[model samples]
Target: MDCRRLGEAGPVVSRVAFGNSLTAGNQLADDSAVACVRAALEAGITTFDTADVYSDGRAEEVLGAALSTVPRDRVVICTKVGRGAGGGAGGLAPERIRSCLDASLKRLGTDYLDLYQAHLYDDATPLEETMRGFAEAVAAGKVRAVGVSEWAADELAEGARLAREMGVPLVSNQPQYNMLWRVIEREVIPACEPLGIGQVVWSPLAGGVLSGKYRPGAALPEGSRAVAAKGGDNSLRRWKFLQDDTLERVQRLRPLAAEAGLTLPQLALAWTLHHPTVTSAVIGASSPAQIAGNLKALDVALEPDLLVAVDEVLADSVVRDPDLTLSRMLRRPRQA
Candidate 1:
């Protein structure tokens, strides 16, 4: 229920931004989708995160239709571009950006977006061409601020510089950051910290791996993302969390959450937000009450001792070890 500033007074956005990346309604009925959005809004979640590619924009339609119920000014509307209608070549082509925004506006049923982000970096596209499109959006007052998702620190820095050179505003960046996934801690945080760019993190729960569901010698839950996402190259990486005692560390946190009077999910969310660089934690949900469970993390600060305990539990754990997945160990830093 608590809110935070989006960049410099853009809007007071919810600490826990409701997300529809998965709620894009591949199967949900239109009426059920409405209930989901209504439930999120009623639960005091004012900020919504969606993408153009999600369900081929059906997600945006549902998200927009839901937000329409509330006074527009009361909600923080965030949607992304660059990822286009089709999966191929979803970059920030200048004309493509314009068309993308115009279509999103129509789908969202809004004149402007509170926070419009680039879905991902287009290495093939010229940086200026892309950022300039965002600049155009800002100039036209169709978007309040421009942000990027899943971009590396260098990419963000370049984008910020381009925004400045072009006299545009780049306010936020979304990256996959969590205690377990601290890849950004190495360079991304340092890059954005002094530049006035904020971080909105995805997978703060490691795709629900940190939700405290798995146990030692346990089967992946029947209907959870862990079991259902076993197709070729699914990002869920079925049972991947058990690669090196991840679930063990997560289970350890249960008693730690008990001590803190919080649920494991709450503890997971709080730990991500505990970092100063994070501006908001995006919580994607299937039903409405998922937002409520996530919102319990509001203001639930993790104490240092518990954090130390977590670190100690993970001290012996190994991920990205060169010995495992050794083929491309030369490509990136080895997990120690």
Candidate 2:
């Protein structure tokens, strides 16, 4: 439950953020979802992250209900925009940004968001327009800070410039980062560090691949993410870490975890937080125990030698290409 500043000028939040992606979309029962949120709060997790597009906005409703009993100032609620309502269309257009923020606030039963992020970079909408929209949100007291997720290094630099011009504190960049996924380290971190933007990293455990629950040659665990993928949840499939080759490398890390008195998930999460640029690691869970276990990483800090050992073991298995930072949307041209 250690606290860290969201960025150079943002509010301090818990080192580990409770994520609602799983709790949304009927992925977990409503009671279980509520219990998980309650557990996180009991454990002193002050930050909760969700997106409007998650479970078609059902996730925000669940999170809102869970947080209703807590004092609003005691928590930092972070949600996103630009994924669009359903799949129709979404961008950083001022209108869409304003609409999404209002809808998210209504669903979350909150008057203001501690942090409102763009789910991804909108190549279609001018960055200046998006910054102005966020600026307006801040001026109106609807949002305290602005952030973006999965944006490339160049895009982040440009966004930071516009945000400064608009008098908005662009505080965070939510990107995928973990022991096995190091793409953000090369360029994104460097770009953000100077801008005073910290990272709120997602998928810190690589969709449970770093949990060592998925054996390399054995059958997928009965209730693992791989099993969920087989049941038509293709979200985890995009990460190549699920492949046998990567799983084998993960298996090799078990010895290291044992030596450090850490679970695979803790080891993975700790590695992500080791970076100074990382403000928080977002973790999703289906049960209270899962949330409790992941929170242990906040107390476990790896030594310098152990950190090096991790890289040595994961050498060549890590995904480090800067080009990989681009989302599928960023890779393609906006249709006319």
Query: Number of the top candidate by lDDT?
Result: 2
Q: After superposition, how far is residue 230 of candidate 1 from its true place, in Å?
A: 9.6
Give the per-residue lDDT digits (tens) of candidate 2, residues 1-336.
789888899879999999977555556877888999999999899999999988789899999999999999999999999865333344778899888889999999999999999988776777788899999999999999999999998999999998898899899999999988888888899999999999999989988888988777778777665564232236555667767888898999999988999989889998898888888999988679998887788888799889889888888888888777745435565689
Models 1 onward score TM values of: 0.87, 0.94
Q: In candidate 2, where is summed lDDT lowest over 10 consecutive residues?
A: 228-237
| Clash numbers, per candidate | 0, 0
Per-residue CA lDDT of model 1 for 25-98, tens digit only, reads 65355676678778778888888888888888988998888878689988889999875433345368788899
Task: Compute the lDDT for candidate 2.
Answer: 0.85
Residue 323 of model 2, lDDT score: 79
The residue-level lDDT of candidate 2 at 146 comes to: 90
lDDT of 1: 0.75
> What stretches of model 2 exceed 4 Å from their correct place?
84-90, 229-233, 333-336
